[model samples]
Target: MSGTGTATGTPTGNESNLESAMQLMIQTFHKYSGNEGDKYTLSRGELKEMLTQELGNYLGNPQDKDAVDKVMGDLDANNDGEVDFTEFIILVGALTVACNDFFQEYHNDDKNDKKGK
Candidate 1:
């Protein structure tokens, strides 16, 4: 499939796997970013909502104020009490890398188990 953009700002829908993943990331970010304050940034409330709703499984209990506070502090690189798209992307990228590492370790362990049988 050709990975090209149309003049209407819509993707050709023939994007490669990676391209589709990237688009999903953008869409996910915007889905949670523009609820409270700036349309382009995620306020604390918005971030908490997104984390609780979208990443609850990975992040554990979003109702834990301390956990949310730590995450907000860590992700707010500018100390502006808000997370911009770049900051949000960084968080997602870090999580993705960590998940990849976890999967690699699991796969290796499974392979070893099979070999031992």
Candidate 2:
């Protein structure tokens, strides 16, 4: 990468960049999932399954049973056992931040490696 804030040779705040990247991911998920209807939603099981399958190594098996249960408990709003758009957005926002932090660490490690070389 060129740099953190100016990676593309343009100034951008970390939060703004993060939001933009997340919006793209959200739009892509909506399109790929065919969530065209206003009432479209995903149940806890479906959400966890999708996260595990799509996110793969990022999610890392949910740590344990309690972790999985806690996540479902938090995201399943309305007591309907499903996550709506709002819940989905919140869930994805947290996940995106986690993924971004991982990438930042990897980038820093790579930079250190280059310097060592």
Candidate 3:
């Protein structure tokens, strides 16, 4: 990695991949949060849009609004009807953990299969 922190500089223009991902997380939240009421938080519509556009593959298309509503209800945390950065981070952390668990399990299963052959 270069001293300027450009291991492979992304459009986010940060230090490393981890740094870039962190920056992207902040950037993404602000991108959607600013579209509506608080500007520092995400209204339901903004949340739905963010999830649909940013997490469509992981969260699914959310063909019914119920999923969005449920997510909003879960992430609101303070009953404010909006998702703040902290609440959003919780969601991201949770999803990350889930993905990690899945990948680890998949890898283990694959390894076991290989051993069986």
Q: Write the per-residue lDDT of candidate 3 for residues 19-116, one digit (tens) a residue.
A: 66776898899999998799999999999999998988888765559999989998888999999999999999998999999999999999999999
Give the number of the best model, judged by TM-score. 1
TM-score of each: 0.88, 0.55, 0.87
The TM-score of predicted model 3 comes to: 0.87
Poorest stretch of ten by lDDT in candidate 2: 1-10
Q: Which 10 consecutive positions of candidate 3 have the poorest summed lDDT?
A: 1-10
Return the clash pairs for model 2, or none: none
Alpha-carbon RMSD, each predicted model: 2.5, 9.2, 4.1
Worst 10 residues of 1 by lDDT: 1-10
Q: For residues 1-117, could you state the per-residue lDDT of candidate 1 as single tens digits?
A: 246474322467788788777777777788888787898999989999989988899888987889888889999999999999899989889989999999999999999999999
**Candidate 3 Cα misplacement greater than 4 A, ranges:** 1-14
User: Deviation in angstroms for 1 in model 2?
Assistant: 32
The local distance difference test score of each candidate is 0.85, 0.64, 0.85
1 against 3, candidate with superior TM-score: 1
Which regions of candidate 1 fall more than 4 Å away from where they truly are? 1-9
